[model samples]
Target: MTMAYKNVIHGLQKDEGTKENLFALVFEQGMSTNAASIKLAIPRSTAYSWVKKEKEQRSAAIEASEIARQTAQAAAAENLKVNLFALVFEQGMSTNAAAFGLGIPPSTAYSWINKEKERRDFTGEASSKTAREISKEDLKENLFAMVFDQGLSTNASAIQLGMPPSTAYNWIKKEKERRDITGEASSKTAQEISKDDLKKNLFALVFEQGMSTNASAIQLGMPPSTAYNWINQERERQSVTAEVTKETVQETVKETLKDNAEETVHETAREISKETSVETSVETSVESEEASTKDADSVYRVTFKL
Candidate 1:
């Protein structure tokens, strides 16, 4: 008999007005259409079409869920970006600093700022900054001064101020792009010299050569405040090195003293032992000589009496 007939004999087939085994076999049992069709006594085409429809439905459901998850993530990310921009634009935080505070990368922060700037520029949106934004303006002015007056590269300036390199580079680049449409060459250094040389010189003059901060600042042609700031930061870095060296030196001195003390004690003990040994040997030799002389005298006396 056919498997369909066997299925009917075994009561696997549903009676009239009951749930059909064709769908049950494919859906619940995960059977292939050919197996389900044979087992449920149904046409192969019917089983194939049902399975295809179920597969498409599941695929559409999965796609919809994924889109919803992405939408939620985007919304959350937008909120974070708003806070990041507020820090950069209003509070004068560097883009990298803001990004770090928000647990993001420097490049992502730079990209977001650039995109925002482009959007604002395209729309001609001149957002007014509060009084707090003076710092940002000051930063821009100082960066430009470094670029135009000091002949320093944006990278060097950024390093000097502990700001992100990309932020400074892009700021200078954008300013140059704006002025390119107008016209004037900024005096940025061609060789991109590291302004850190100034710091090194300042430190050498003050810490190494015993010069005062004022004298170092004068010699370096840097402002007194800048000199102090740089020197103070350097001092913090060197403080750790000094502390470790101090501990190492203390331990070395202690070990040397202990070794020297032990050697001195051992030498003193050896000298004392040698002196005691020599004194004891001399006394034994003198006592033996005295005893031999007495015995010789007594033997002569006894011979004469006999």
Candidate 2:
């Protein structure tokens, strides 16, 4: 019968949820069309159509009662944003607390603060960085204090300091390496072992005791890859020493065998020469005896003839 009814006839139809929500706001909560529209993030015309449908079945007193309340809420929110901006920028009050005190959402307050910063910077009234922005040095100092004094983890400290976990981890690593912090162990072991000692133990385990490099490393609380590297280096060194010693032993054995062979040949030649000399002396003595016998026979014959 009214203009609202006319609008409802041509209005786009919404889903059941939207219709139920509109019914609750308009009838149950007694909110006006404009207020319900703002709260529901819908168009005022659409809310008016929904309200028209409600009005055909309900009374006008509810809408009138909620109009003043909705107007007041709209005005208060606008003023609250202004106050929140001033509190955050001029009075140094945190946006979160200011928003909570004024009954504004924290996310909306943060958005307003960012808008204010942008406006101020555009007008050349604000510096490049906001007063709330923390410097790298201050952040690092706070992170260090949180980790050392409060006993927070690097990740937790970084989160509190508004930094990435990786950045915090890298900074801590650099500091530990630079300061030679012995308290921090790579593994879960309470005691820290020196590299030389680690290498020695690894060598004894793998080479002497025939343990696998990975198992030895795990036993010593070292990384398996690191153990593998150390083992390879030690094996190379041993191999070089073994080659040198083997060559030396071979040369010594060769010289000893050569000396023994030469001495044996000289002694064999002397024995052969002594046997030949004995044979020649016996032959000469036999020849001399035969010649003497011949001379005795000739003397006997000449004496008998005279």
**Candidate 1 lDDT, tens digit per residue, 192-246?**
3335567778889999999999988877766677788888999998999999999
- Model 2 has an lDDT value of 0.75
TM-score of each: 0.37, 0.38
Model 2 Cα lDDT, one tens digit per residue, 1-306 = 899986776563544567778779888998887888898888889778877877775666677668888999889878997788766665555566668777888899889888878888899877655544444556667776665444445765665555557888987777667546665445533123345556888899998999999899879766577788889988899999999999999999999999999989998999999989998898888888888888888889899998
Off by over 4 Å in 1: 1-32, 39-42, 127-133, 137-162, 165-306
* Residue range with the least summed lDDT across 10 consecutive positions in model 2: 185-194
Error of 1 at 3 (Å): 28
Superpose all Cα atoms of candidate 1 onto the true structure and report the RMSD in Å to 1 decimal.
22.3
With candidate 1 superimposed using the best TM-score fit, by how many Å does residue 124's alpha carbon deviate from the native?
Answer: 4.2
